[model samples]
Target: MGQTIIEKILSSHSGQEARAGDIVVAELDYVMGQDGTAPLAIRAFADLGGKDVFDRERVAFVIDHSAPSPNEGVSALHKLMREFSREKGFKLYDIGEGVCHQLLPESGEVGPGSLVIGADSHTCTYGALNAFSTGVGSTDLAGGLISGKMWFKVPGTIKFVCNGVLPPGVYSKDLILYLIGRVTADGATYMAVEFTGEAIGALSQEARFTISNMAIEMGAKAGLMEADDKTFAWLRRFTSRKFTPVTADPDAVYTRVLECDAAKLEPQVARPHRVDNVVPVSGAAGKPVQQAVIGTCTNGRLEDLRIAAGILGGRKIHRDVRLIVAPSSRRVFLDAMAEGIIQTLVEAGAVMVTPGCGPCVGTHNGVPSDGETVISTANRNFKGRMGNSNAEIYLASPATVAASAVTGKITDPREFI
Candidate 1:
């Protein structure tokens, strides 16, 4: 009845009255960076003759992407980032800690009622925990690195209400992909995204993370769901930090609203190059797939692995397709191993890699051939995004990726399930 999650986070950072479309300067509660983009900001920081970052401890640098670089140039770039972090008093998250967004929440740096800015696009992933987070460019990051405060034109929010339940083999990725067809890529540009409805309340933290993580593809500043009991219960195991929950005001004005009674959804896919290039599952069926890779900050949870494993338990990967999988974090990886998921996947002809954002970022591992096509569980199918610019990439849910791995072609997940 008061304000939405985005509004509450902004209010905590703003002392005076705040309203949508107002250009307000708010001090960032957390500043995040990863290997690929951190060095750029560092270079700009030096060019500005900055002595030390504003509130060094609040700035976080992560070495998750291309950690052990796939090439020499990438390795050198990572070295520069390491040097920058060592010189600055920032909290540099080194290799093995995990992806930037995951480590942010895992370290308790992302709390409720805080505004966070990250150099990486998927920074909105933190919104699952009720923080207002968004991505920024290196230039803006440099400004924030020098001054703790940054400018944001408060964005109007579009509410997405989901009711009913998801069928087996379906996930948040499917829902978002389907919605992209409705809203397109630029639909939410400069607009905050607030997700509601019973399905959202019932989602696991991992599942919710999947939704908020991909919100960036919709050009969304942030995506938030009500932090109800499930979120609180999950946080209890991770931190002792206490904070107030923020939700949308009953009468909050939304520039637009989307409603989906999720029970009607089937496995959905976004065909190559653009997140908004969405179509029904049947549209992509029977198309030959040369590779099937799973794992990313989104849909890299243990539950995602379990679903793929159940489907691939006794089957071998398609003769023409390669199957690879990566866990989201060390914790998720450990849990999967303890439950024999690793063995099941390996036995079923899948390659299990370390926990990191590899294929998703298109830097390390899982490089496909020039003309090959792949069915990926990671977000984004941007042309040349996965290596060879000419290679085709199709984006889909884990179930679809798994089914394709077994059949060597894009098949509706419903058939396999």
Candidate 2:
């Protein structure tokens, strides 16, 4: 009986053989919290009588969501996080740095086969490196901070084998949106999803990050891709730390197997209020859009910005559409600027905001007005997700958003590409 990737990682951390449905206490390599959750975690840690973290170096706090202090209240929260990090001697990433998920990988805090837990649900984004990363509530994070160990009920793995070549203008976002639509958002609840096959292997590390970043939309515990040469190559660019890539055994059991024909996939869009309410872009084309965003942890990588810039180059956005662009990290922002991607977007009538999660959570930048329609590259389009319950939010790839920004409607990216 071979073990799945999750099983193997858990077993290695637990120092014993393990399987799905088994609760095991495993040592964690990293623990993190952001401004929205760190204060709660700090409070919980103090309540546990934890005078000090088990490993100060392994803990991190990032002030990202609503960064640059949306209000005095958020500023107070930032102050609290700063005070806590100072008191605990842990690492802290402050405003203008970027979203926690993107910054962590950029900082080389995430690696293959490590167990990482963060207070943000999107912490699962690190699974792109084959790490066993998951999101937890503040209480669980507090416990991990105090003891350096956490309990996990190992989850069954769902294998998604993506074969064939991706068609023109199609992206990992479109592929994941298609999967989420088929899986119906909560279909993979409490399970691990491991992407495999030639398409997965061929994806850039950033593209893999996009796919794994959205796995939470399907209610997955973790979304992972097997670490391979490309993974190592990407990691090398950031850190010289050697990581032993973790792979599923040849006969590892899966709850179920799904096959995706990447060549046949089309541009997809998630309609207002539900990620699973996805349809081909054609279904939503010609619908008016007053706003379009081309950035988020889900699609705000350098490649994503390049794709949007390529489509928007030399073309102005529609007069009716307000286009906002945010780079996922300061590093990505600088790289984009060096490559002229930012200037191209700005020249194309897009508003470039800070590197932090601009307009994604509706906290600070680019919030839509009542009854307006927005096409965005960000994940989640639930009612009130963008700080306005009356606004309609549609989710699409960066290229789709870029094309639509020019046309002021839901336009298929293929037409522009």
The C-alpha lDDT values of all candidates are 0.83, 0.92
Can you write out model 1's per-residue Cα lDDT over 1-417, one digit (the tens) per residue? 355567767767876456677778888988888887887888888787778888877888888887667778988888887787778867887766567777788777676676889999999998888889889988788888888888888888889988888777678889988887789999899999998888787778878988999888889999887787877777777888896888777888788888998888888988987889988788888999998988888777888898888888888888888898988777878888999998999998898776778677677678888989988988888898887787899998888999999989998877766
Question: Cα deviation of 81 in candidate 2 (Å)?
Answer: 0.3
Off by over 4 Å in 2: none
Error of 2 at 401 (Å): 0.3
The whole-model C-alpha lDDT of candidate 2 against the native structure comes to: 0.92
Query: Model 1, stretches more than 4 Å misplaced?
Result: none
lDDT by residue (tens digit), candidate 2, 1-417? 999999999999998898999999999999999988999998999898888898988999998888888799998889999999998899999998988889989878688998999999888999999998999999999999999999999999999999987788999999999999998888899999998888888789999999999999999999988898888888888998888888899999999999989989999999999999999999999999999998888999999999999999999999999999989999999999999999999999999888878888879897899999999999899999999999999999999999999998999988987
Q: Give all TM-scores, in the order shown.
A: 0.96, 0.99
